[model samples]
Target chain A: MTIAMTTSPEALTACCTPTGEPAMSEETASSLAAQFKAIADPNRLRMVSIISSSENAEACVCDITEPLNLGQSTVSHHLKILVDAGVLTREKRGVWAYYSLVPGALDSLAGALTGRS
Target chain B: MTIAMTTSPEALTACCTPTGEPAMSEETASSLAAQFKAIADPNRLRMVSIISSSENAEACVCDITEPLNLGQSTVSHHLKILVDAGVLTREKRGVWAYYSLVPGALDSLAGALTGRS
Candidate 1:
């Protein structure tokens, strides 16, 4: 339910302020960049899309790898990067790891870029 | 006011559908990834932030570099990437090159990720 990014508290706080308000501090830009970087790969982008579209807006590694035709390790790798970026949350249920979008994470990122904040 | 990404029409069409709708084809994912890759760097994100927050929601390279403490060449490099990705529009006003967000570009990207479509 709760996912945390590796970005520092200060950077995270500064990451999604509406554009044109002020120049972002270097730390803030770097933090935001990291989030973008996580989804910059085609495989990762597809993984996010697949998980987001799943029932209950969540999917396990098993579900993702099949549709993506990617190996489990590869899917897991992408999932880890997303989780580290705070874009996705990982929950362990029995032998499976289920990934879900962190509420508002993408919205805030989008809001930051689109001046929607 | 019109900015074009290097992404093909098919990819563009596929880029912004709601995430839960279906798995993105490889081309769509790649196109979306290219857009994300353009903004994946700290400097680029700041450049976008600076431009988005400016008067009329636009900024020139000169205006952007000064605030970021970067050189003209460095700033230009980042701008070109954004333009190529179709995230920003480049306009030549006399000798200065002005950059503005491509209308709805960020919104579409955000919509894809956040299920806002």
Candidate 2:
């Protein structure tokens, strides 16, 4: 529910600058932190991996919950966190919500790790 | 005191895998989380910025504390965390300890964020 559209790499770059730079602006820190917070938890991190490695780099909540050995609602909550972080994309298909990687979102974050991007 | 030698990028790369590929191994998660946890604090994040943007990509604790408006002990603690996380390198110079960016540590973390190495 607290998600916004991070529609481009520039937006992500602008919002999530290098720590080697001037740290990051407060808003940028908060936004980038939100994305990191999504993965801060071990459960959510695992969920992201499972979801990404799924068929076509995406998976539905139903498929995600099984390998996780967690409750359905718990899986849904984690999925929402990833979607909100701009790390994953979610689409509604008939009666299910399908989730996939946000193309370069992870790559952008990876770029921060490499100091490029 | 809880830190170990993270001497190379291969170590960093092998240690910190892509979150999307799979949740990082537990050991990798703990190590990478230690780095993120270092920056999780607002004060530390700010301090890192000031230190990183300083001359020579490094700064002494003496220069770092003033701009932060924080206690000297607090600054020292944060510096230790960054050093331990492998994000910043430390060297003893006479009576002072000089800290500098650990080359690609942040880049590696940024890699995690962007989903690359």
Candidate 3:
């Protein structure tokens, strides 16, 4: 998946350098772009909002599909894209999968964008 | 163009409520996605980094194209997208257009993503 091409969470976390601080290396820009691309879709952004605001900041696919008005398969696809980008983590609970925001992932991206590190 | 559909900077600034705080409304999600879509390209992200790190936190298109290895037209297109998204402000200086990061724009986006007010 495209996730393999993204910067590791460790690299991303350490990369709190703001856009105003320095010129971004091609590698860093590519990695950041991959993460942004994950959330660039309207459906995925809504899914992130819904999943993030859910109980424990996590939710099952069933919990999101209805509010998003997207079918289960579509929601699942978006979830996979997010997960692959390291923005969300997936855990297996019997027959269903639960997804939760990865701690610090969003913060790292924010820091990079805002130069708030 | 598409910028007309985006949420106003005022709305985005007041939207530091964070993703975990509540489910984002469709209007909010769409606006955020439009902003993300603007920077989702690697070339654009690099251009932003270069421009933001330049003198006075701004740069002329000529200053960025060579480092970015992109033609002036391509660089201008990306800059226009960012300006339209309100992430960057454009000013005419003589015959050159200077682009600078809009104050607090990235911070607002970061705040929304990271749930930091």
Candidate 4:
């Protein structure tokens, strides 16, 4: 909330000379922020754990509720956040929905953090 | 807020067995969640990028405020969160506090996410 109006990127680069160069463009920063925020909650982390470790690396909402003891609706909300953030993918099969990790998404994010992306 | 009371780990393991085994224990999940929460903001991500990309991989609060267009106090607050989460280490140099990444912290976190930890 304390984010003030940004000066141009050029202005920024000109002003800050303590480094060889700036990295992490504003666009990339915003993108990774959304991705990290998607999985920052305890329940969400637990969900990812359970699913990633589950059979076929996929899980149903019913399976999700037990470990975290969360309601289906609440779990759905968290899952939606992950899906929206591109962390997990959701597929509907009959009445139940299954969630799985988007391939290489987490690894790609990890690479970004280590500046190896 | 959706996090409910956890069942014993054994009960959880017994109930959800669609896989060879469980991964990412509650304690690890909680710890990683806190760490992810610490860097989930755009400004915070930008700060990390700035510092990691900077000279000697260290930066002062004064340098942080300009690029992110944030106030020094607000930047300090974010820095404290990263420091508290063990993402960054702070050093006092005269009147200024210098912040640098904890070596391998980001990589270790990345490895944990990819199950390479």
- The superposed Cα distance between candidate 1 and the true structure at residue A65, in angstroms, equals 0.7
Candidate topping lDDT: 4
Deviation in angstroms for A42 in model 4?
Answer: 1.2
TM-score (chain B) for candidate 1 is: 0.79
* Superior by TM-score: candidate 3 or candidate 4: 4
DockQ of 2: 0.14
Q: Sort by DockQ, best first: what order?
A: 4, 1, 3, 2
Determine the backbone clash count of candidate 2.
19
Global CA lDDT computed for model 3: 0.79
Q: Compared with the true structure, what per-residue lDDT tens digits does model 2 show for residues A20-106?
A: 444446665566556666676666666666766665777767566655568989888888877887988889754567788888777
* Residue range A1-117, candidate 1, lDDT tens digits: 856543657434432334446687899889889999999999998888887777778887767877788888988988999999999999975455779999988888887777675
> Which 10-residue window in model 4 chain A sums to the lowest lDDT?
A3-12
**Which candidate order results from sorting by lDDT in descending order?**
4, 1, 3, 2
lDDT of 4 by residue, B33-79 (tens): 89999988888898898899887889878778876788988999999
Best by TM-score: 4
Candidate 2 chain B lowest-lDDT run of ten? B11-20
For model 1, the stretches where C-alpha displacement exceeds 4 angstroms are A1-21, B1-21
Tell me the docking grade of candidate 1: acceptable
Which structure is stronger by DockQ: 1 or 4? 4
TM-score of 1: 0.79
* Native contacts retained, all candidates in order: 0.58, 0.28, 0.54, 0.56
**Model 3 residue A64 CA deviation in Å:** 0.8
Model 3 misplacement above 4 A:
A1-22, B1-22
